[model samples]
Target: MERLEKSIVITLCNLEKIFPPSFFTIMIHLVVHLASEAKVAGPVHYRWMYPIERYLLTLKKYVRTRSHPEGSIAEKYLADKSMTFCSRFLHNVETKSNRTERYFDGYYGASTHTSLTKLEHGQVHRYIIFNLDIIEIFRNLHIEDLKQRYVYDMINHFHIIDISFSYLFNIYV
Candidate 1:
């Protein structure tokens, strides 16, 4: 613990040497006090307000009425609490909490297993590649490179066939 404090002090002093004094804000200054605070409080996670802040944020979302936010939040909170309690007792009803998980149930009408056939996989892969705007320039550059490489008669013949095949499978389709 003492070594850690010394290490932090040395590190902060080194940082001070490299960066201007004005760059050290309150947050940066707070780092020097963290080791002592951790020693006093045991651990940072035990003292975090994230869960309470998150729940408060959720409650804030329940406020539908602009003029009477407090009343809206209170009413929604009560309604949600009652609904949750009722859902616990009702086995047949499809409350949000009681519904099967989306992953297992395939709730979006998608298949549970994404086992595509080879042709389907190829089509999907080709669709994604062709749709990417950044790759269009690269694709054109590659076709130019192929034309340069296959300038000989026999290779040029194969290149013509390849070009016709690519034209048949154009984006215009």
Candidate 2:
């Protein structure tokens, strides 16, 4: 924004010099405020009439007869809603309402097994350590306690990693 603001102002200033003062109307000045206004109000879809307009357009498409659009829209809407309501109980057959997300991740409660390389494992650990937001004082105290305990036990790093993760795997499976 800092960089873009300078360019926007410069362009507007250039236009001011190129044209008469009367050319700079309220609408022209409002161009500078669009980005800031969108930031304050959030994306256009959330704050604007876009979703409502889209739904109305869909309803408009339901109009089959020129005599009464309201009746056609109402009839089609009720049919669609009733079918959606029924589609939930239809486990055997595929339906619009029961379709998976665009990028499907397999069926619900299903998962894939993955093996992480040592470098990938270290990267993940580093990411969590840097990004996790536990209270700083508590985290420091926990780390100090672990250091003291591990140092007192004089356990080698390899021995710690040798600890079996089978107990965790057993519980999950």
Off by over 4 Å in 1: 16-24, 105-173
Which parts of model 2 have CA positions greater than 4 angstroms off? 1-8, 14-29, 35-46, 100-173
Cα lDDT tens digits, model 1, 55-88, are 9999999999989999999999999999999898
lDDT of 2: 0.70
Residue 13 deviation, candidate 2, in Å?
A: 2.3
Model 2 TM-score is 0.47
> How many residue pairs clash per model?
0, 0
Residue-level lDDT of model 2, residues 1-173, one tens digit each, is: 55665577889999999999999989998878776776678777677888899998999898997699889899999998999999999998889977878897766876889999997986675555435675344445544555676684543353342232223223433
**Residue pairs clashing, model 2:** none
> What TM-score fits each model?
0.50, 0.47
Q: Which whole-number lDDT from 0 to 100 does residue 67 have in model 2?
A: 98
Local distance difference test, each candidate: 0.76, 0.70
lDDT of 2 at 48: 83
